[model samples]
Target: MAILRGNPGEIIKIWHGGIAIHGGLIGGFIAGVIVCKVKNLNPFQIGDIVAPSIILAQGIGRWGNFMNHEAHGGPVSRAFLEQLHLPNFIIENMYINGQYYHPTFLYESIWDVAGFIILVNIRKHLKLGETFFLYLTWYSIGRFFIEGLRTDSLMLTSNIRVAQLVSILLILISISLIVYRRIKYNPPLYSKVGALPWPTKKVK
Candidate 1:
């Protein structure tokens, strides 16, 4: 936007931290609390349902990158894509400078869609909060790789790719949590603990 404003030389520093990222997490947590309170559902079970939807939405949202013509990698050529048997849409729309650039957004969308499908199908068997953690893990893993390929990325003062760094950390944390829970709890989907409660349990 700043560049479009005829100030192409001007550099705008946008604050990326604070309540923005965590707001979604907090909102998800609050929604889980509300669903568990009203429907008598397990918080983890609610997370299982919500986590897939989040990924699906993210995948759908990534198309905005194509429309904006931003977030694409260095540069590429149409002939190269055609020779490699790449999709026509990509070959036609994404090539530049005789080199094929990485479509970071497309890669992320595909990864998110795949992750959503896997998480949704297996959500029922996951322990409470496991699906949420899985969402973070899977999304972060893709983000770390994709961020590295993106031409435009948020950076820290030390010239580090902030998103990639955070994504790597989240991936590690999610993996550790999943492994620890799998080893410690070993929860089953059909267990009495996981099942929806009987109606006779009256509201307080």
Candidate 2:
């Protein structure tokens, strides 16, 4: 981005130029669409199968932020964090630079882990094309609030957190798509599509 903007003054000097998860998601979706189109496949159905793993990856990826000591919240008391009953190692790690901070990265990682578990368990029940949207809804719900706790969030303005804004939009869009699909098709949300045990037949 710094090179594209032709200005290095405002760019944060991070390896790989400060990558954002949302940007990667958008890029992946576009590539998935193109590939699925060429392959004559239903993009949403493929996305459904891939969604749980995506969150699982997110759960594991957050530790990178932990190691880097970024994406943490404001100063907090040891007593306050201790009340949460977190493990000693985590508590000790949170005590960085002589101050304890909320482990926002850990919070997000746990949220993503829970999401992955729930998605995997409920996946067979969701109709084709619905699981992916459910993933978006579930993830955004957590990301919306989690992003609030982060001091390093990307911002569009002084008061506007970019990830929170994207989360809100994704939540709305995913919910709308789910509702529309339910009303229009009335498909069995809890039943498998057919004998194939997968909905690769068509976009229906």
Clash count of each predicted structure: 5, 0
Error of 1 at 100 (Å): 5.9
Taking the tens digit of each residue's C-alpha lDDT, what string does model 1 give over 1-204?
334257643433324323223346656678778867787666655566578898899888788777667678766555655676767886666755445676767788899999999987877666666788889988888888887777777666446787777787888888897787678776545223444553234222
Residues 57-108, candidate 2: write the lDDT tens digits: 9999999988888889888999989999999888888888999999998898
Every model's TM-score: 0.69, 0.86
Q: Which window of 10 residues has the lowest lDDT sum in candidate 2?
A: 190-199
**Distance from true location, Cα of 31 in model 1, Å:** 6.3
Candidate 2 structure lDDT:
0.84
At residue 143, what lDDT does model 2 achieve? 92
